[model samples]
Each structure stands twice: as C-alpha cells, then as structure tokens.
Target chain A: MQQALQQKVQKAASAIAQECFAMRVRYLNRSLTSIYDEVFRPLSITASQVNMLVAIITQQTLSPSELGGILNIEKSTLSRNLDRMRKAGWVEIDSSQPGRSHTVQASEKGQALLLNILPLWQKAQETTCTLLGSERSKAIREVADHARSEIMKT
Target chain B: MQQALQQKVQKAASAIAQECFAMRVRYLNRSLTSIYDEVFRPLSITASQVNMLVAIITQQTLSPSELGGILNIEKSTLSRNLDRMRKAGWVEIDSSQPGRSHTVQASEKGQALLLNILPLWQKAQETTCTLLGSERSKAIREVADHARSEIMKT
Candidate 1:
C-alpha cells in the first residue's frame, strides 16, 4: 500500500516538474529573442520581421496569401507585419490585383539593408548554436517545428 | 575536388533548411497565439497575458521582478506585458520600495473572468495534447524546458 501511494506521489511530482520546465522554455525563447532584437535593432528590424523579410527576399515576389502559406503565419499577422515594413519603405506592396490581396517584394533599399544585417544576424545565430550545441539545438528546433505544425493544423 | 564541393554545398543546404524550419516554427507560434488571443479577445487578453495571469493565479502576490524571473521573460518585456495587463484591470501594480515595481494580484473582476475562461483554455490544452499524443507532447515540453534553461545561462 505504501509503495503504491509513493508511486502516485512520484507521478504527481514528475508532472508538476514537467509543466514547470515547459514554462521556462517559453521564457527562454523570449529572452533569446530579446537578445536578437537588441542586436538587430540598429538594423531597424525586429527578429520576427527579419525572418519574414528574408523569406520574401528569397522568393523575390509573393502574394500575402502565398507568403502566409509558406511561412505558416496567419493572413492577419503577416498583413500587419508587411504593412509596417512597407510604411518603413523596406517593401513594396502591389495591391492592384482585383479580388486578391497585394503581392509583396522587398525594395532595393530593403535588400541592401537585409544584406548588411545578414552577417550580424549570423553572428547572433552562431552565438545561440554554439551555446546550445549543434545536436541539441537541432533537436530543439525539430521538436519546436513538429509541435508548431501540430498546433497550426488544429 | 568535385566530391568535396558537393559535400560543401550539401552542408550549406542543410544549414539553410534548419534556419527555414526554425522560422516556420516561430511563424506558427505567432499564428497559434493569434487564434488564442482571438478566443480570449472579449476579455482583452493576449495569449501571453493569459499565460501570465495563470501563473499569478497559481502563485499569489508575485512581484514584477519575481514574476519576470519565473516567466523567463526579460524584465523589460515583462514590464510592458504587465503594463497592458494593469491597464486592462487584470493586474495590480504596487511597489515594495522606491523605483521598484510590484505587480501583486489580479483584480476581482480579473479573477472572476479567469475562472470562466479557464475551461476554454483547458479545452485548447486538451485538444492539443490529444492531437500530439502524450509521449510526443511531453517531449515537446521537455525540449522547450531545455531550451529555456540554455537561454537562462547564456
């Protein structure tokens, strides 16, 4: 009887510790993002925005729907993010297509700015990868990717 | 020479793919958060704020510094998140001493509203866990925890 009770208690404690750790992960991501954003701030881009800009630049031209589809970002969030970038003169939004949203492409200035920021971004990425190690960092990215895919499909 | 060049190109491709996957993960998290925020919009709470509220409800009278520490959020980010929560009347601001900010507890209305919303939040959690499976879901959380600890030390 005592052994069974102890087993139950152990299970409860394990579950509690697990949940506690998960919350820590959220903060860790936020903190790391803070660091990247600080470094990228001089470039006049947010870490999230830099990711989006790099995507758009890679494609050269993409409709909002297409961009959202590729990035797994919501139509709304991408729209707002793109709007900010546009207003900042970093992207050109072509909204002339009837019954369809605008297609977005980075401006020449935007591309130049992105080129300047890429090396800095790489430095930030290297710091994180070095800290986390290649295997563990890749594993965390894989798990986060899988978990994110699961959530979006919901 | 040709074989070595091929291997170098393959390594570059793999590196790009890893960055792509990480960006996708970040985008999905942003989108999933938008959905959760929409669900709790009437309450004027963002998903992260809801998470903070849940943390506070679980632990009474946590200061902003202490709460920031627990959340793994930067002190500045926590301050900003707390500002909005305070404006929404979901959290109270106090001070233990000069120039120190203490976010003590939720308002009565905030407390009552959280009780009502808890079920909806739990439903989301249950559905996600069900979709991901217990083992994979647990692993995701564990990896997230590991990531958080890694960031904390860095």
Candidate 2:
C-alpha cells in the first residue's frame, strides 16, 4: 500500500510537470521576456513599456481603465506605469477633463521617442520572428488568439 | 513633410501593436497564471510553488542555480521563492554541504502537500486543455519548446 501510494505520487508529479499549462507558459514568458528585455535594454525601455506606448499611440486617447483593458494589465500596474511615463515625458494624462477617469495619450516627446526607438523595435521584432521561425511564430499567435477567445467565453 | 512623418509614426505604432511577441506572451502568461493561481489558491500554494515542489521532488536534490535553470526563473526570484518555501516547511535546504551552493529538496511535508493538491492541479490542467482546445494546447507546447531551444542557443 505504501509503494502504491508512492507510485501514485510519482505519477502525479510527472503529470504535473508535463501537462501544466501555467508552468510552461511562465517559462516561455520568462525566456521571451529575457530575450526582448536584452534586445530593448540599449533603448532604455522594457518590452512591456514599448507595448504600452504603442497602445497609447495607436489609440491616441484612452482612459486608464480602457488602457488597462487594452493592455490586459492590472489597474495598479497600469496606474504606476502611467505615472512613470508621465514623469518621463512620454505620456500626458488629462485628469481635469474627466468624469471619474483620466484621458491618456502620448506626448510630443513620447511620439518623438517612439520614432527614435522604431528601428530598434523593428530589429527586436525581426530577431524574434527569425529566432522562433516564421511558422512557429504564426502558430503562437494563432494559439494565443484562440486561447484568449475561449478563455473570455468562460 | 510633417504629414509624412506622422504617417510613419502611425505605421510604427501599428506594426508594434500587430507583431509584438512579448506582449502577446505576457497576456497569455497573466491569463494562464491567474487561472492556475485561482485553482491552487485553496491549497495554500500558488501554481509556481507546485512547480518548485515538483522540481525538488523529481530531482531529490538540486542547487539553487540548477533549479532556477530548470524552471527558467530569475536568480533573485528563485532565491526569494526558495526562502518562502523554506519558511512554509515545503523545502529543505542543506547549506552545510560543501561548495558555495546549497542542496534543495522537497520535505516530507511538502511531498504530502503535493499529494493533497494533485487532484486540484489535474483539474486546472484539464480545464486549460479544454479551454485552449487540444490542438492549440499542443501547438503552444511545441512552440514553447522550439523557442526555448532557440533562446538557449544564444
């Protein structure tokens, strides 16, 4: 009976190691983030910050909550990043024109910074695609989109 | 000329929004971690903790750097988590052993906790696989493996 229980425990540990989606995803996240962070380090911004700037620029104007939703960032994290970006002259928040929300948009400095970083960002993207291989990259995007839709349904 | 520059900036922002791998992976990471964390919450452990326990159990003993490399966790993050697990009585570290590194393994209590949490962890895995669909789940694993290999080669 003790041996059977040990076997069961071993089986469970092996299964968990092999099949845990969160663990695998987190590993990928750490690995990919490390790669991208190294790529963008010379540009003085992290990968997520670049995404935030892109989202802000793409939208032109978004309330904090809307930005949070778009970026899928936590409210507190979004607020903190917005504060940092505001301080960095990369974003402007118009709280006075708000009804319980503030409008966020890229400042002229932010836009200029984006322009400056565009080449490096492109290089980073190109490096990622090349490294992951075009086919795998496409598969990742497809899976990501499908997973997002399915998760949202639940 | 000004209009052309604005168009270029917009194009850059649009490109980033469309093709940023780091952002997509982070979204998936956050979503998947949230799901697994919620599933594991009642067990008084996070999904990452389960992974740590599994790694410790499977290896019997590993140096902190070895464990971090296996899990792809950062050095500081791994150190902190190991400290927490030690405090929780889930892991035993033998610093008395020779060399600069300590050996870590799951304690009896930790092994028991793993047995206790196995069913819930299986449920989380099943739910994720079902939600992602088998094909996409498989794709995620394949892509994750390929990316890991590529990143490690650098």
Q: Pick the candidate with the highest DockQ.
A: 2
**For candidate 1, what is the DockQ-based docking class?**
incorrect
Clashes of each: 0, 0
Q: Which stretches of candidate 1 lie over 4 Å from their true place?
A: A1-29, A87-89, A98-101, A147-154, B1-17, B20-25, B38-44, B74-77, B87-89, B96-103, B107-114, B130-135, B151-154
Q: For model 2, how does the per-residue alpha-carbon lDDT over A1-154 read when each residue is reduced to its tens digit?
A: 2777767777778878777788888887887787778877986888788889999999989999988777667899999998988998889999896477899999888888888778887777787788789998887788777776765564
Best by TM-score: 2
Q: TM-scores of the models, in the given order? A: 0.72, 0.93
Tens digits of per-residue lDDT for model 1, A44-145: 788788777777777768898888876777778888999999998889998887777678987866766765675676777777667556765665566566
Q: Against the hidden true structure, what lDDT does model 2 obtain? A: 0.83
Give the Cα error of residue B60 in candidate 2, in Å: 1.9
Query: Which stretches of model 2 miss by more than 4 angstroms?
Result: A150-154, B151-154
lDDT against the true structure, per candidate, is 0.65, 0.83
lDDT, candidate 2, B62-109, per-residue tens: 999999878888889999999999999999999896777889988878
